[model samples]
Target: MANLGLLIIRLVVGLTFVGHGAQKLFGWFGGTGVTKTGEWLESIGIKPGGTIWAICAGLFELVGGLLFSAGVLTPIGAALITIIMIDAIVSVHGRNGYWLTNNGFEYNFVLIAVVIGVALIGPGDYVLFYRP
Candidate 1:
C-alpha cells in the first residue's frame, strides 16, 4: 500500500512534468513551443533565453520526469526536479509572496517538497529499477 501510494505520486507528478516539457519543446498540449517559450523567458530576464536554454529546460523536465516515473536513478531524477523547481522559484515565482493565488511560489515549493520527500523516502517497491 505504501508502494502504491508512491507509485501514484510518481505517475501524477512525473507525467505532468513530461507534459510540461512537451509543451515547451514541441508545442504540444497547447504549449507555446521553444521559440515562444524562449521569448517569454527573455522577457522574464533569463538572459540568453533562446533555443538552447529552452532545449535544456525541456530535456531536464522530460528526462527527469521519465526517470522519476520509472523509478530509475531516483536520486538523479529527484535532483533534476529539484533544480528546475529551484530555478522556477528564483527566476519566476519568488515574488508575489507564497500563495499561488498571486502567482507566487506555492506550487513550486510543494513540488520541491514532494520530490525531496520521495527521494528521502525511497522510490518504493513498485519501481522499474531500484538503487539504494
Candidate 2:
C-alpha cells in the first residue's frame, strides 16, 4: 500500500514536470516554447540568453521527469528537479511573496519539498530497478 501511494505520487509529479518540459521544449499544452520562454528567462535575469536557458531547463525537466517517473536513478532525477525549483524560486517566484495568486514561491517550494522527500524516501517497490 505504501508503494502504491508512492507510485501515485511519482506518476502525478513526474508527468506534471514532463508537461512543463513539453511547454518549454515544444510549446505543447499551452507553452510558449523556446523563444518566448527564453525571453522570459532573460526578463527575469537568468542571463546567457533565453534559448540556452530554455534548452537546459527543458532537458532537465524532460529527462528528470522521465527518470523520476520510472523510479530509475531517483536521487539524480530529484536533484535535477530540485535544482530547477530552486532556480525558479530564486530567479522568479521569490519576489512574489508567498502565494500563487501573487506568482509567489509557494508552488515552487512545494515542488522542492516533494522532490527532496522522494530523494530521501526512495522510489519504493514499484521501481524499474533499485539502486541500493
Candidate 3:
C-alpha cells in the first residue's frame, strides 16, 4: 500500500514534468517550443535563453522526470527536480508571495518538498530498479 502510494505520486509528478519538458523542447502538449521558451526565459533575465537554456531546462526536466518515475538513480532525479524548482522560485515566483493565485513559489515549493521527501523515503519496494 505504501509502495503503491509512492508509485502513484512518482508517476503523477514525473509525468507532469515530462509533459512540461516536451512542451519546452518539442512544442508538444501545447508548448511554444524551444524558441519561444527561450524568449520567455530571456524575458525573465535568463541569459542565452533562446536555445541553449531552453535545451538545458528541457533535458533536466525530461531526464529527471524519467529517472524519478522509473525510480532509478532516485537521488540524482530528485536533485535535478530540486535545482529546476529552485530556479523557478528564484527566477519567477519569489516576488509573487506564497499563493499560487499570485503566481508565487507555493507550487514549486510543494514539488521540491515532495521530491525530497520521496528521495529520503526511498523510491519504495515497487521501483523498476533497486540500488543496493
Ranking by TM-score: 3, 1, 2
Worst 10 residues of 1 by lDDT: 46-55
Top-down lDDT ranking: 3, 2, 1
TM-score of each: 0.94, 0.92, 0.95
Ten consecutive residues with minimal summed lDDT in candidate 3? 43-52
Higher-scoring candidate on lDDT, 1 or 2: 2
Candidate 3 residue lDDT tens string, 25-87: 999999989999999999878885458889888889998899899888888888998899998
Per-residue lDDT of model 1, residues 1-132, tens digit only:
999999999989888888888998999999999999888888888887467778888888888898888887877888988898888999888977899999999999999899889988988888986545
Error of 3 at 69 (Å): 0.5
TM-score of 1: 0.94
lDDT of every model, 2 decimals? 0.87, 0.89, 0.90
lDDT tens string, model 2, 112-131? 88888987998889987755
Error of 3 at 111 (Å): 0.3
> Candidate 2 — which residues are off by over 4 angstroms?
130-132
